[model samples]
Target: MKNLNPMEVELKLALAPAGPAALTQHPHLASYPARKQSLTNTYFDTPQGDLAKARIALRLRQVDGQVLQTVKTAGQGGGGLSQRQEWEWQVPDHELDLVALADLLPFQGQLSSVLHALAPQLSTDFTRRSWQLTDGLVNPGAIGQRSHIELVLDEGEIISGGYRTPIREAELELKDGDPEALWALALTLSEQVPLRPSDSSKASRGNALSNQHWPLPEAHSPAEWLHRATLALDAYHDSQQASFLSDAQQALATLADHPALDADARVYAQALPGGLDAHGQPSTAYGNAALALAHRLAYQTELR
Candidate 1:
């Protein structure tokens, strides 16, 4: 295991079936070398879901036959960008290493009592193809000065009981430099690939599958509306359910008239209807609009 920042800042994007090929062939990423890995990750929680109730995720991942334990707290901000506190360590096998975790968790005995009863609830098996991008090369005088990022495309499935949800997404993690650069890079790549900013993580998706419950987002403001619309778009793509598309249309309509919406953002929201109408069909225009919506939502600060 290598040293990593305790704070994890990353952007997750929902990808179309052809998104992988489009991104890999993009001019900015084509010349760079890439690496592939097979990962199996199992998530743990108490029988009563104590850890999930507390918005904590405990996972054991097998990478190249080496096992790693990771714990992540509930993060803030969605639609594209999120920040959370994470702790990871290497363990001998696929078991909880309480001794190592004891030094990292904030409350000792309170959580430890439940940790002892934890069991595997769900797992994700996937293949990841990744690339490392450095400053001054990809963006050439881009904003935020210099930036470093790890871009990965993940494909696989989330399995729990008899249900399995397919996984096709891309992630961009800030290795070093300005966080603003993430949105910039995503925007440039999204122009060619069909991408939608996502708030759903593998753990959340598995949990949702286990319980068979899909909830809708509540929106009161422009920023919240954007969040609702983007999540709806992704959900529609995943299930091809008409209700999700209706939800997206409603949210977009609200955002189109909201007083707080930026002039530039309103244009994206207005253009989304054409893409939404073409849902369940194949068209890059729909993806371009979805990506544009995500980009605008990521920069909204009114929620604060």
Candidate 2:
């Protein structure tokens, strides 16, 4: 994509599913919500004066459950100090329904006026567009620590994929809503994506493998098990090769209890170190001992 001036590019907006419509229109804000409509401004700075790479956004909602507007700034690369602003207003719930939020006319005049006022600092010929897609999913886990995933599909391209957290067990992202699109992408990328081993199917088994709580298993939930197995494999790798003593010990503990090891436990157990060195660090002897333990664990299931 050619870089446009951030100031000149038009804002893109979409209303995502926030929650049940009933939850958004809770009675608490009814009386005062009408008075809250206005252009709320936020600002940021960079020594290079480039606002295009910096992100800016706005959300508008009525006292009732109606969302009036949603806006996002474009990040076209430009060299120099620049500023991007977003303007939004709440739509009255009594006057419009949820679908009205996606209508282009409601804010067309306002958007024009704002764009005109900033025209000297921005480029003209910009226009607004909208598209719809199914809502994304939140990772099923604890409160205050939820993970989210979003997928975008255009034409025949698979635009994006990745984990929401640094240490999540498994994450799957499908860009297009079409089942065939997803299937084709999966087939094309099969070798690039890691496939889980079949034997470790129980969710409860993960608890015995690592310190982290693993999600319960349900039909078609191999991702979680694969995640646990990966972590167990990581710990085993660390125990055998990491330089830090604490890391090695922790890895050893994880490996010793991992449910995946069938015949390897005995060999691993025989490799663990006898004691710490004079410097209060694990000695080479300890590393050897840990290795022995790991080998035994890898080879013998009864040791677990």
Candidate 3:
């Protein structure tokens, strides 16, 4: 297998239960054969939640009878888009290899204390169907663009002790070129299937399940409302109920004049109501707009 880049950039979308079927049958993807894999991912952390507190994740993934250990750090960006540092290597078995992990991580000194306490906390079992797109193949309109992306649909369950939650989401990883291609493909896909940008990763969701609570963010201002809207979009996907969708719609409605929203983003935001609709479906318009606003907010906030 080929090694991935140490810096991982991806856009995650929360898919409806029926999304895989719709996505696969879509005209653009219907002809291409999907590469499928059964993946079992086990997440590890210390009994005292030290790794969680440090915003680090350790995982052992079993696929094709091979075991790969990976370590990830929380980097930046939100609203279903993120960039993070990751290190992965083949390991002997389903065991924690602190020595190997230490070789890959930058903070070796910090590992001495927490290494012994590390143990498996949760696992996600899923089937991944994926396709690769290059240049303007995914976007004929933007011919000669230098962009390579891998689009995947994952379906399965997150297992934590006695608790379990379904996993139905799409991920677009930027293998090469501009990250904007991710949004472009997502926008195209969302036109046919409802999609909500996911702020929660499987690791975060597992921790939430282990703790039995998902704390909601208070939306007091434009930036906060933008965050809340993204959360509501994800929650609605999980529940498929009207209340959560309503909250998302309401939150998005208040962000037109948000200082962080640029002209293009504002236009998308304005178009959101028509896409968000009352059917509890979040469109690609909503996804890209949320991401754009979030990026702008981060950029402006950093300058202050």
**Which structure among the candidates has the greatest lDDT?**
1
Q: Cα lDDT of all candidates, in order? A: 0.77, 0.27, 0.76
Query: Across residues 119-195, which tens digit of lDDT does each residue of candidate 3 receive?
Result: 89999999999998877656558966888899999999999867788898999999988877877777678767767
Among these predicted structures, which one has the highest TM-score?
1
**Stretch of 10 with least lDDT, candidate 2:** 154-163
Please give, for residues 166-244, the per-residue lDDT of candidate 2 as tens digits: 1111112322332222222222222222221111111112212222322222222122222233334333322332333
Candidate 1 vs candidate 2: which has greater lDDT? 1
Better of 2 and 3 by lDDT: 3
Q: Name the TM-score of candidate 3.
A: 0.84
What lDDT tens digits, residue by residue, belong to model 1 across residues 161-247? 568878889999888887777877877787888777778778877776777665777999766887787777666655567898888
- For model 3, how big is the CA root-mean-square deviation? 3.4
Clash count for each candidate, listed in order shown = 0, 40, 0
Candidate number with the higher TM-score (2 or 3): 3
